[model samples]
Target chain A: MSKQKAVLSEEQIKTRRGRSVALAVTLGVLVAMFYVITIVKLGPGIMDRPL
Target chain B: MTMLEQTQGLHEDATDLGGRGSVSDYIALLKPRVMSLVVFTAAVGLVMAPGNQHPILSFISILCIAIGGGASGALNMWWDADIDAVMSRTKKRPIPAGKITRQEAFAFGMVLSFGSVLTLGLVANWVAAGLLAFTIFFYVVIYTMWLKRSTPQNIVIGGAAGALPPMVGWAAVTGDVTLVSIALFMITFTWTPPHFWALALVKNGDYQAAGVPMLPVVAGETATRHQIVLYSLLLLPVGMAPYFLGFASVFYGVGSAVLGLVFLGYAIRVWRVREGDAAKKTAMSLFKFSLFYLMLIFAGLLAENMIGLV
Candidate 1:
């Protein structure tokens, strides 16, 4: 027995690509936002954290 | 395969997958207009709070509040898709237009809701996050699901959810609610009825057809108009409460009084005109003016606060 695979049309593929890029951009922004927020929360004493 | 055959195959695959919405359609789920007002009021509240917040944290707090408000809006569209399909104003919304499914909207709303609340907690404080969570819950469950269809006083009570943003902003700064924040809350709270009832007057038929018990639909236009005037009158003092409470300056007080008077005048026009196109035009005018009234009131407070800071 052969397994059936889902196939996407050209338009669907394009849309999928668009969604992926948007998600990636959003995640990147979130990462940057968290980093900045973390630094802001830590203040000038951030380097004083014990390793 | 020939070009035509390949195209046909692609079409078949696309059909099988269903209609995929564009990014804009997803953004539409957030109700950006309402989010803007939320952002404005929340920012005002943050600025008006006694303590100083770092500009970056303040920006992040506003961002999170806006996202939380948008998340509630998405959840509202998800729940109200049925009625949204029937109403002229809402029929073109992403869900009703079949651009997005309910499940997708629900997931989007939930993700943003949790993300915003958690992020706000991590950055600001738990009190603000807790308020945001409550706001989302109140808007989604208490207002949209329960009160909206069941009562004409839906927006009256549910208006609390909208009124909470400023309080949330205040909490983010002070870590506790205070009388000044409550004064800010009261302004928006008192303003909501007249603002919404005015729109309800014009959209009576839409609400009727959609079976949503808007004030005009449930209690008739006369009562709604009367309520609008009454609320508008009540709003004058409430709107000026910040100034009276010593939080805002005389500029805000005078501005709020003038705007409140104009808002009342519109409401009176809405009350007097009760037939045909003239009625709708008056109602629409009031509705439009209501937006500016609220925006200007908040802007005045925000401006005063900024001046005080300087």
Candidate 2:
């Protein structure tokens, strides 16, 4: 037997899209924040360390 | 099926399939107004701390503190949805208004709480993270779940959670709690009762209907008014502690004194006016003035520190 898919209405689609965008923006900001913090914490000698 | 029946079925199915809330609804769950006060106070604390901190780290610390504060608000809303539904002021909140489920709020709160605390620990220090975790737990478990429904002294104890952000911010910088930070904590702690009790006086009926046991509901309006006066009096010296402790300049000292006096004047009006619209107006005036009083007090500290007047 095949299963049917649920179709979303316009309002539902808008809400889902808004939430997706918000989540994406929030995650992107978090990533950027972490990167900046890492660079700040490590200081100018960050890349000078031995492998 | 008839045309009307077919349309109704489609409508129902659409509603059921649709997402329950928008991004603004989720933001509403965070109590952004309360979060703003948290950010301001925490930023003051971070700036007032003794050590020199990187600007980027300080910004991250304030952001984490704000997110933690917002998480606590979401958790509080989850626990208080029932009472929130009954209260006129809170009936339109996300959970009570059916824009979000309690389980979803709980999950959102938990995620933000953990994420914020973990990030602060990694970027700042564990002391700040530990305080943030404790603050979330205190507000959610101790205040919302336990004290709020149980006693008239609910906000009195719960105020500690609201008062902890400055200490958390200070800890983020110094990695230790100190006397100056404790002074900031004391000012907010003492200010909470009068600030909240003023509103509680006006919203006594809402608390009574919601069965929340606010001071006005449990101990009567006159008693609550007296408590407001008492707390306002206590706020005077507590607000000036930074100046007395030699961390703030004489200007901050004088400003805090003047603000505290004005706060007391408002509280006196609340105590003197005892009936009808005048009474409510007086109480509301005190409530509004209380917010101004706190902002000025913290702003004075921030200004003093920034101008190197401390």
Candidate 3:
């Protein structure tokens, strides 16, 4: 059903490809950053091994 | 169709905010079977801990553990999306199959990770919450991103995070660590290689194709099987530790002995066969039995605690 939709021009295709790639890369970076910050913040508390 | 038409389709997908995909797709991304084992083992740890948590707090604590486990799965799926797309078994996962956007998965994982950790700290104790947070980070960043591609020992080290649930449960109750809880952690730690290597043996090609650096991919099948036997033997002694240490009763002792023996028998058969139909059959059988072995050992702990018939 969705496949029956009208197609776009060459310039539109190029722009769309660029946008999705950008979105994916942005998400990847954000998630990685979130974990890194969380770890750095929580490291002292979590990694405190009893001497 | 022109290149323009293809690009437009892409834009439509990107902009289609109203088109929420199937709920089943998101559930598939959680890797429910893996989550189930995490929940069960963590629960056993909580239940068998030396002290008791208030019922409401205990419920919240376990809920956090489950969510934390799911969060780890989500992040793992997110990072391994490329390889997941290539492998047949995992190709249908949410991100790989395009059932859910990568952005959505990342968001889901982050929210759950933060919520579970914060809630655990408030409802249980900071120690347990802290451990849960570290487990999520280690699995997602250290193991999934780094060791997985770099070395064959990925699972060996990564398995630590997997093994910590019970310790977290124990910590939730007592607000501190103990020898007993660490021993529980060690049991799962030792069991992981044999448990995973068996699957790696069966799915060697998948790892090879994905360049996963799995033990069976880097080490030969013979070596992997031998290691499985070694870990199985070591686990036998470790499995019986609770009984010997007076942490559990004779029922647990009997159950551990039987389960460990069966696990050893399969591992030995896998080691001896060396190749062909017989080897594959043994490897797969060992893989299936390994799950039962883990569950039974923990179940025995719960039963002994409940019955009080030491």
Candidate 4:
């Protein structure tokens, strides 16, 4: 069987890329902020917590 | 335009408002303005709680509360889309505007609600999670679905959902609500009637068109204005309960007292003046001041607690 090529409209591709980037950035920020706050709040013994 | 006709334009875009949904549309569905108040009050609740929480947990708790608030707003928008479409004020909302499908908004709200509650449960305690869940149910199912269209006393009773955020925040930090948190809830609870009624007085037609039984629509402006004065008078003492209970400093008490009088003054203006543009203008004034009234009162509490002035 012939393989079907992936086809997407330019606008669709752009939207997909934009949404992916936004979601990735949001998740990254949340994770980073959580860790940063954990360090700030927990202080030098941050690693000692059950986290 | 008639209510049905007003919705025709949004309906024509069956493809939906502005072509397609974007991140911003989702944000709008969450009612960012409302969520800001929720976040601020919740933060104030967390701060005023008796003990210190780990800062990370505190951040997570606030985030979860914000998510819960946003989720509830989305659900309200989802269910209220039909009424919303008919109203000029809400005609451009995600579902009504035709940008997001009702099904999409409902699913989005469901996911966020469950995610927020589960995250809060995992990261903090179940008490706060339970409160958050109940808040979503109260606002979405009880307030929006049951009370909004059926009764003139809708905002009076439904106001409980909006007033619960501080208690949620207090629970998040302390794992239990105390007398002080109850006092905080009371402040917002009492404040809601006048705040919403002021807007209802201004936009009575929208509610009438939507078949929503807002007090101003059902009771006539005169009666609704009377109710505003009554609630404002009630707020006089409830606003100062924090100070009287020794949770706030005398300075904050004086500030709250001053704010209460100013709020009462605006409500009294709406009560006594009813013959001209001044009537709507006075309602608008009370509406505007009530927004600042809550922000300033809550901010004062936050400052007093953070500074240990109480």
lDDT of 1 by residue, A1-51 (tens): 779877778976887788788899999999999999989999888999988
lDDT of 3 by residue, A1-51 (tens): 466875666755664566566569757965774565455445667577576
How far residue A36's Cα lies from its native spot in candidate 4, in Å, is 7.1
Candidate 2 residue lDDT tens string, B1-310: 5322332222123244336789999999999999999999999989988888899999999999999999999999888887787788998998778777777788899999999999999989999999999999999999999999999999999999999999999999999999999999999999999999999999998888788899999899999989999999999999999989999999988999999999999999999999999999999999999999999999889988898886
Ranking by TM-score: 2, 1, 4, 3
TM-score of chain B of each: 0.93, 0.94, 0.93, 0.95
lDDT of 4 by residue, B40-61 (tens): 9999999888787877788888
Question: Model 3, stretches more than 4 Å misplaced?
Answer: A1-51, B1-20
Report the candidate with higher TM-score, 1 versus 2. 2
lDDT of 3 by residue, B62-131 (tens): 8789889998898898788777766778877877666566667777789889988997897778999999
Overall local distance difference test of candidate 4: 0.89
Tell me the tens digit of each residue's lDDT in model 1 across B8-120: 22222334344476778888999999999999999989988888788999999999999999999999998888778778898899877877777788889999999999999
Off by over 4 Å in 4: A1-16, A29-51, B1-19
Off by over 4 Å in 1: B1-19
Best by DockQ: 2
Most lDDT-accurate candidate: 2
Pairs that clash in candidate 2 = none
State the displacement of the C-alpha of residue A32, model 3, in Å, after optimal TM-score superposition.
32
